[model samples]
Target: MSQTKIGALQIGSALSSSKVTIQKVLDYESQIKDEACELIVLPEALIGGYPKGWDFGTRIGYRKEVGREQFLHYWNQTVNLQTDDLKDIRQMAKRTQTNLIIGVIEKVRSSLYCTTAFISNQGELNGVHRKLMPTASERLIWAQGDGSTMPLIKTENLKAGSVICWENYMPLLRSHMYSKDLNLWCASTVDDREIWQASMRHIAYEGRMFLISACQYLGSPSSLGFDTEWPDDKELIRGGSVIVSPMGEVLAGPIYGEEKLLSAEINLDDVIKARYDFDASGHYSRPDIFKLNVDQEERIKN
Candidate 1:
């Protein structure tokens, strides 16, 4: 597996419903068929929606009745893994012969998790990686994930895995993922800040892996009818989707204020070449001096 083509689809969820978003994804997959991407990564929370400025009506110490109602509505918006219509998504992947890594709000009983689903080219749901630590306010809505769901998917073409959104900031987590000898690192995120690009490049250079960061592009606030104080003309989440080479070179984009699919052809040889001087998990790691311990226990059993 010397070279392969991968793509990152940057688009926001339909504010109306998950079904609409699912259709949007299916339509995009059809349009990109000619691009011939072996692997496609969709933005985080694409199925369930990101809920940009909503606070869920919560504050310190007191949880209001309105908050509870708001929470209930949000919970209803989550994807039920056992009952939801994921067949279409899987079938789409098979039709295109493209592997997919997509983010969705997963509902497990009463709990909701920010999860990334991995779909193989055969249209099988291979595995899912839940966001271990839901950043800041996200903790209020999403339950923290245990390590039991961490997945490193090995395909005939490449060894791939994902770190959702801000998880890229965790040094120890990066070490754990790097130890798996991954060639492709996928990041499904909604963080559209300029600083986020730097982190993507840094991680690619640090891990000596091809990195794909897919971000959401929520257009003008008024379009979504979101209840927020920001001006109606302002963009909610401007996209910054991008792809980076093992050497931290920008291969695809950091396209902003628009929705687009960015693709890059990666040569696996570059991973080895970039690591010749520094392999974070191999030669460069002084095991005698430092070590990392990971707990893979399931926090909640269904």
Candidate 2:
């Protein structure tokens, strides 16, 4: 088939935990089973909550007991891919027969990393893409991902990959992924700013690929009983879930202030059509003058 339906689940972490969040995913998938969406992307940190205003009680140089406790709580919330409750997610995907690209907080030994988990429609854990860089204060909680986890997921129809949140701003990373000739670019993020929409459009136009960005729609943390600096009436993350065509047209949405699934039907041929004028990785590239070396080795810090 030259055409497929894609969607973005513009939701946030549950008020309680990732378990509840997982159930929500299952429920949503069941609701959309009739939509016939071949691929659906979920927001960043959907499994593990994105603590918007917490500092973990940290100081410049000294570590506080409360901070350590906070960190421990967060670590406990992370999903251990080896021994975690992922069966339901896979089963839901199987039931819906839809490919899922979801953001998760991955627990590895003593550290955590912001990562994307790919589940095939047949209920298989295909692979994952760990965020190469964590933005700002995120450095304190999440570890940097090595190139080894940057996978280009190939299916019967097309090639797809994910770049999480701020990692979208990395030009070289974008170029490298563009070189893979991706047909779908999934962005799992919590960045709901208006400018993020621009970046999403730019990436779609530049890569000549369909872009699906799923941003979180989190209300005030205060409602969740956390002490937050944000006003009680304010939303922590206003969703900006959107879908863009290969030619940079807004196909689905840039929806905000609500929780909804945004979907659009796209023709795979559009990727080639958009590239007729500019193919960043093909005829438009100056391979003689510019080259990128990506080390796919998984780095271990001793």
Candidate 3:
């Protein structure tokens, strides 16, 4: 079987403006494509940067009306499903003939969601997945996503799936992907080094699927004042993007402290080979004794 070249674009903060950040993402796309990567995965909320709760203080400083106006301006300034910026990314993807999995802040009517979008090499917009649950301070800004938006996209080359940030910690969510027979699992996160690496290892071994884990390391202090000063010298993300094989091998990177494009040629057959010994949701799981049901549709319906 032919191998697939998958990549993780570990990016630094890009909070300047929608246009500028979009350009940055596009530039990185060009760099990755030149390296012959078939798929490129970016960090969470890459278009707007992480922990946008910092902007709230700026919003409060203005008069009530001014604050409202400024809030509207910034809110409108964020990226979404239909933004022209995405069109640029789509066009680039078509030009390079490389699939892209991007994380963006999606604006839907009056509300915002932490969302991930998949685009084909031909620039076709695939389905999107929003964060099922926004953790802690994130709840202040993003609306929790419903189950209806959850997706598992099948391409000619791979049956792929994704979940945002903390959702990787959800066992049932991972099981849902496993039930779908997913071969490639994309996890976009904003977690620290230890938790991020541990989670990647756990998912690869547990699911017995290839994992492309991309995390943003925004050095910006928690907007909720968790820290007195930014932990790092510069308020930049310390990247921890990696690719793990089915056997829990670290294939590419857990590259830290820099923006980079890490790539690896992964053989799809490894998934089946690993499963030959044991599949967590299959032979390894004694369902007759204990079963986990994930009524995703019902959860969202309520």
Alpha-carbon TM-score of each model against the true structure: 0.97, 0.97, 0.87
Model 1, span 151-256: residue lDDT tens: 8997778889999999989998999999999999999999989899999999999999999999999987788778777678989999999999999999999889
In model 3, the runs with Cα more than 4 Å from the true position are 52-74, 83-85, 217-228, 231-236, 289-302
Return the clash pairs for model 1, or none: none
Every candidate's lDDT: 0.89, 0.89, 0.77
- Residue range 160-204, candidate 2, lDDT tens digits: 999999999999999999999999999999998989999999999
Each model's Cα RMSD? 1.1, 1.4, 4.2
User: How many clashes in each structure?
Assistant: 0, 0, 2
Q: What lDDT is obtained when candidate 2 is compared to the true structure?
A: 0.89
lDDT score, candidate 2, position 110: 93
Higher-ranked by TM-score: 1 or 3: 1
2 or 3: which has the higher lDDT?
Answer: 2
Q: lDDT by residue for model 3 over 240-289, one digit each (tens)? A: 89999998899998988766788889999999899998897788878889
